[model samples]
Target: MFNKIVLENGLRIVTENIPYVKSVSIGIWIEIGSRFENQSNNGISHFIEHMLFKGTENRTAKQIAESIDSVGGQLNAFTSKEFTCFYAKVLDEHLPLAVDVLADMIFNSKFNEEDIIKEKNVVFEEINMYEDSPEDLVHDLICQTMFDGHPLAYPILGSSSILEKINKKNVLDYYKQYYTPNNTVISIAGNFDTDKTIELIYKYFSNWIPVKKEKDEQCPPMFYRRIMGKTKNTEQLHLCLGMKGVPQGTNEMYHLMVLNNIFGGSMSSRLFQKIREERGLAYSIYSYPSSYKDTGMFTIYVGLNPNYVSTVLQLITEEIDKIKNGGMTSDEIYKSKEQLKGNYILGLESTSSRMSSMGKSELLHGKIYRPKEILEMIDSVQREDVENIAKEVLDFNRLNISFVGDINNNQIESNFKKIIG
Candidate 1:
């Protein structure tokens, strides 16, 4: 069982105590990310995540690193489309030092001008690194094509041109506007005294006052159907086919999970078996569902010789058509349910995973389903539920496509229309 407490200023603290483990994982989750920014400040959320580690009022960057390192602990952070997280893992005895270091970074980071300029260059290099990977670049291309005009399409790592213009004032303003106490959640898991942990959290975070910022109304992104391509000089063509999917915090997500597992999510799935095992057409082929707050995308990816694009796509289309036309068996559904339960249970064995699961759930959905409840939900998904979600998610007319590598866009688009139509 997990415990939750809400401070007077609306800061939420959630914890799970595991008496057997000696280490504890703590996460500070903020409900702000690229989705909250506009064209001018597209990657500010991710940028701030980097800056918070550079230095703070009381500790130099080296000292911050040493604080955790001296204790044999780990510290890191990441930014996503909808949120950002800074986390640390240390032995239970070092929890106080971890909390103090993290709180200092959050509340007193000095986003100096010199650091801003230097980090911009670092982020630019990071973008270059991403561009070098055709497989990874193609996935972002799919989002740009599917979400076209929405902020959700904005890359977490903003483009160099926009990032170059961001100054300390811009960073500070954005940070002040979104990084509020009420907009955050702290989650901890592993061995600890629950009462002592709560008091420790309050000691570090209670006095932090909330900021008043006007709420920005976010309209859900509309899914667009278009073929987007990037001409990269790479050996194999990287491809992504996307369709509409369900949003977060819904029963429909479980249904889609069961459907995805049987379709292409696992090694024994149809896409892997037919494309890689039997025909040996591609080295990699898979599908996944990415859900956001209000909308989601189901993506299928394949990496193969450009010469084999037509054959691979045709095989993928055939699989989709088969599933749409009542090809899935009850046995597949039962097996997928068991697989999901096993994976979920195993993932909980890690304190970091549990902390993340609790933090994201409380920050986004304001509720966390216990393991038994989630397993029951997965078990209860009937064949009809999977079929219904499949029909909704696998609409051929609404599918959007993206590709990267040495291929002619016109030829690939023409082939897609001819085969998928």
Candidate 2:
């Protein structure tokens, strides 16, 4: 069961209480990330995420870490394109301490001048590390090519030029604007008394004042069907193909998941079977769907021998064409639905996973779906739905291709256009 309450200030508190489990996972989900940023302030969300742990007024950075560690608890945080979360998992009894630490970090963290400079250098190294890995870098390249001029294309780690430009004032101002109680959600799952947890949350969070900020709706992403490549001395060519997809919180979103599973989401998927198992053309191949508040991306990734890029690209196009033209059978539809249902159910068994699901749902949709509700949604997908979505989204003419490897520009331009045409 899910329990939810919204504070007067608009902070949302959602919880799931599992009686059998002795552990509890708590997450503070903020409704701000890279998507809310522009070129000048890119990566500020992620940078502020790191800065939160540096220290709070009442707790030194080391003390903050030790407080959680001493209780045999775990604390961590992550920043995504749309949101940032700071979470802690501990024994049920430590829920109060966890709440206190999280609230303090959000409300009282001092973005120190000296610490800002140090973390800036650290983020610089993180950017360099990504540049060193071509496989990882290609995804960013694909995003840049696919989204083009949109803010969605901006790198989450940002660039060295922008990082150097960001300072304490920028961090503080951004945090003040977006870290209001109204822009936050606190989610907990696993063992807890619902009423007691609610009281505890109010105790820690009630005093934080809300800010008046205008709701900013993102402009629908304008996708460019671009074929871009970078030459790098890598062992194998890393290829990524992407197309615009349905946004989050839509009926088509579920159908797209079912479609991706049959196409390349798993080892039994068409791309994996055709490209890896049967032909042995690539060691790694898969497809995934990324849905945001207002836009989405369906992407297929493959790492293969540079010599076989043309052949692999041809086969990929063929499979995509086949699906668009009714390659998905009733059997494939049934199995993929079953697979999606099983995965969704199995994933919910963990407290952390439940916390994350509820947090995202509440922040994004203002509502949460229970296990049975989601399973029903998965079951409702049919063969025609998959085919229709594929036909609408899988046009070769609208595809974006990104490649990184030791390959020449002429080889890429000629071969990609030939296949795409």
Best candidate according to lDDT: 1
Global lDDT scores for all candidate models: 0.93, 0.91
RMSD of each: 0.9, 1.1
Q: Which ten-residue region of model 1 has the weakest summed lDDT?
A: 216-225
True-vs-predicted CA distance for residue 185, candidate 1, Å: 0.3
Encode model 1's per-residue lDDT on 68-108: one tens digit a residue: 99999999999999999999999999999999999999999
Q: Global lDDT for candidate 2?
A: 0.91
Query: How much RMSD separates candidate 2 from the native structure?
Result: 1.1
Lowest lDDT sum, 10 consecutive residues, model 2, at 215-224
Backbone clashes in model 2, listed as residue pairs: none
Q: Which stretches in model 1 have alpha-carbon errors above 4 Å?
A: none
Q: Please, what are the lDDT tens digits per residue for candidate 2 over residues 1-421? A: 6899999999999999999999999999999888789989899999999999999899989989999999999999999888999999999999999999998898888888988998899899999999988889889888888888888888888899998998788988899999999999999999999999999999989888999999676688887678778999999999899898888988899999999999999999999999999999999999999898888988999999999999999999999888988777999999999999889888977899999999999999999988988988899987888888999788766789888999976887788888876
User: What TM-score would candidate 2 get against the native?
Assistant: 0.98
